[model samples]
Target: MSLVSYTKALNRALGDALAADEAVCVFGEDVGAGLAGMTLGLQSRFGAQRVVDTPLSEQAFTSVGIGAALAGRRPVIELQIPSLLYLVFEQLANQAHKFSLMTGGQARVSLTVVVPGSGSRAGWAGQHSDQPYSLFAHVGIKTVVPATPSDAYGLLTSAIADDDPVVLFAPAAALGVREDVTAPLGPVPLGSARIRRPGRDVTVVAVGHLVHDALWAAQELAGEVDVEVLDPRTLYPFDFPALARSLRRTGRLVVLDDANRSCGFAAEVLASAVEAVPLLAPPRRVTRPDGTVLPFALDLDRALQPGRDQLLDAIRSVMA
Candidate 1:
């Protein structure tokens, strides 16, 4: 078995895709230099044409990706910062995402929008530190958040191969996670939920990087309660059936997400679990305060984000 960091795993996936398929290409700012490390060495191996570096126009390049995808080419657009999604929302959500349906299945946009560093990065503050997966999910765009190195590789492969537009968020908090792999890396199907830890008392639904916090919280509370950790790798077209099954076994739920409390991913999970499944008690969700804007100060920034302590408390409250 070999150990690999999450960032390297992403780079490996991009390299593998470029080599495996002639139709696959990548475009972004500084892609030639691979400033994010995820696209490192890609330009050298794939050549400048396939590994393109666009001008500082996100809106223009984002639409260019959509156009390329519509022309039967699989284009992966890399956004160094997550907030850039907001700038090109119309291009992605309206243009790329709606092409297939709008044209009555005449077109399939195989475009993948990759955000390397999503969520808070200590002092990144308000603009650069937005976890906007929920926004994409709400608009019915395929959204994925892979927690481990293996999943990062597998999910990106699947995203590139998908017929519809897909958004892959590599949370900044999870970039450091490393894993040991004995098997050859492969695609992990979209809309699948993996059970990180099995238990019978309460099931904790964690999104993006919060999966680690959920697992740690589960272990910390192991003696007092049996906690199950469920990582819904794909947030949109969510694996609700799997979550429903877990809720059936645990009879309780607690969601840990990085997005804001109001209309966030956690709220959707909590609402769906309650409405579609039987719950022994009210569900709990640990997330940023409603309509939160992360502050510039270190302590104030940390205060705006969810943590293990908050997740543990929520689980305890739900279980009580």
Candidate 2:
């Protein structure tokens, strides 16, 4: 079994997708230079026609991608930074995400938008480090945040293959994660939750990079508190059934999210959990303060993002 890093897995996924489907193509700024690591060597392998590097205009290229998708091409748009998504929010939320429904399900925008380094990336400051998956999920777009190397590979494949538009965020913190690949990698269905650690005391639902923090907390609290860590790979079409089953067994819940606390993905998960199942105690979530803008200072940047200590505290609170 060979060890595959998260970034490498993403690169492999794009390569495989390009090789497997003639309709699949990519558009982004500096993608041909492989700045994000996922598109490394893709241009030479797939040729410039398939891996076309567009001008530095997110909105323009995003619109072009939508047009290409409508014209029967599967376009994967790679955003160097997550916050650039704000620039093309109208294109994604209003236009591309609506075409399928606007055309009475006759039209589909098979477009995949991949954000390689989402969330705080060591003083990228406010402009570059925003994890806005919740916003996309709220707008009814398929949102994916894979937590591991294998999930990164599988979920990206599925997102590209999906007929509807999908936004996959590869959290910056998770980029370093590497796993031993014993079996062949393939598509992991969207909206599925993976139980990283099974326990009976409480279920800790962690999103994106926070999944790793939850797992670490679970390991540290072993024997004292059985914390079941669940990674909601896709936030929009969430695996509510899996959460309900976990909550039934644990009777308690804790959510670790990297985005803002108010009306974030964690809030949605907590809201849905309470309505769907009976809980032994009130659920809790650990997230950045409302409308958090990460500071440029290294320490402050790290402080703003949710970490293992916060997750551990939340888990203990639920267990109490």
Candidate 3:
């Protein structure tokens, strides 16, 4: 087994995709230099044609990726910042995502949008710190937030190979995560959830970076309560079957996510569990308050985000 960082896993995935398929090309700003480290050494390895360093126009280049996909090229567009997603929302959510359905399955845009450093990067503040997976999920875009290095490698490969447009959000909080991987790196099927920790008392569903927090909280409260950790790797096209099975075993649910409260991914998970299965206790969700704009100050920023204490309280509340 070899230990690998999450950022390295991402870089490996991009390299593997480029090596495996000639049609797979990457386009984004500063890709020539691989400024984000996710695309490092890719331009030289894959050549300038395949690893394109696009102009500063995100909206225009985003649509260009869609066009390339339509022309039979699997284009992976790397967005250095997560908020840039808002700028090209129409290009992605409307054009790239709607192609297959709008054309009655005749047209497919096999495109992958990679947001390398999503979520808060300490003092990155309001504009650059948003974790917008919920936005893509709401529009039915295939969205993935991988917590571990292995998942980062596997899911990125799957997203590149998918026929539909997929958005892969690599949360900044999780970029530092490393794992000891024994298995040969490969693709993890989309729309699947993994049970990180098994328990019978309550299921703690964590999103993106919160998976680590959930696991820690579960361990901290191990003697007092049994907490199961469920990581829904793919936010959109969620693995409802796996979640249902966990819910059946646990009978209680608590969601810990970094997104805002109202209409967030956590809410969707809670709602779905309640609607489909019987709950032994009222489910709870720990997330940023509704309409949260992360403050610039250190304490204020930390205050607005969900943490271990909030997750622990939610678990206790559900147990009570």
Model 3 residue 248 lDDT score: 95
Task: Name the regions of candidate 1 deviating beyond 4 angstroms.
Answer: none
Looking at model 2, residue 180 earns an lDDT score of 99
Residue 235 CA displacement from its true place in model 3, Å: 0.7
Could you estimate the TM-score for every candidate? Answer: 0.99, 0.99, 0.99
lDDT of 2 by residue, 113-196 (tens): 999999998868999889999999999999999999999999999999999999999999999999999999999999898999
Instruction: Write down the TM-score for model 1.
Output: 0.99
Q: What is residue 82's positional error in candidate 3, in angstroms?
A: 1.1
Q: What is the lDDT of residue 137 in candidate 2?
A: 93
**Error at 3, model 3, angstroms:** 1.0
For 255-279, candidate 1 gives per-residue lDDT tens digits of 9989988999998998888899989
How would you encode candidate 3's per-residue C-alpha lDDT over 1-320 as one tens digit per residue?
Answer: 99999999999999999999999999999988988888999999889999999899999788889999999999999999998999999888888889899999899999999999998888888998898899999999999999999999999999999999999999999999999999899999999999999999999999888999999999999999999999999999999999999999999999988998999999999999999999999999999999988878879899999989989999999999
After superposing candidate 2 on the true structure, give the runs of residues whose Cα lies further than 4 Å from its correct spot. none
lDDT of all predictions, in order shown? 0.93, 0.93, 0.94
**Deviating ranges (above 4 Å) for candidate 3:** none
Pick the winner on lDDT between candidates 2 and 3: 3
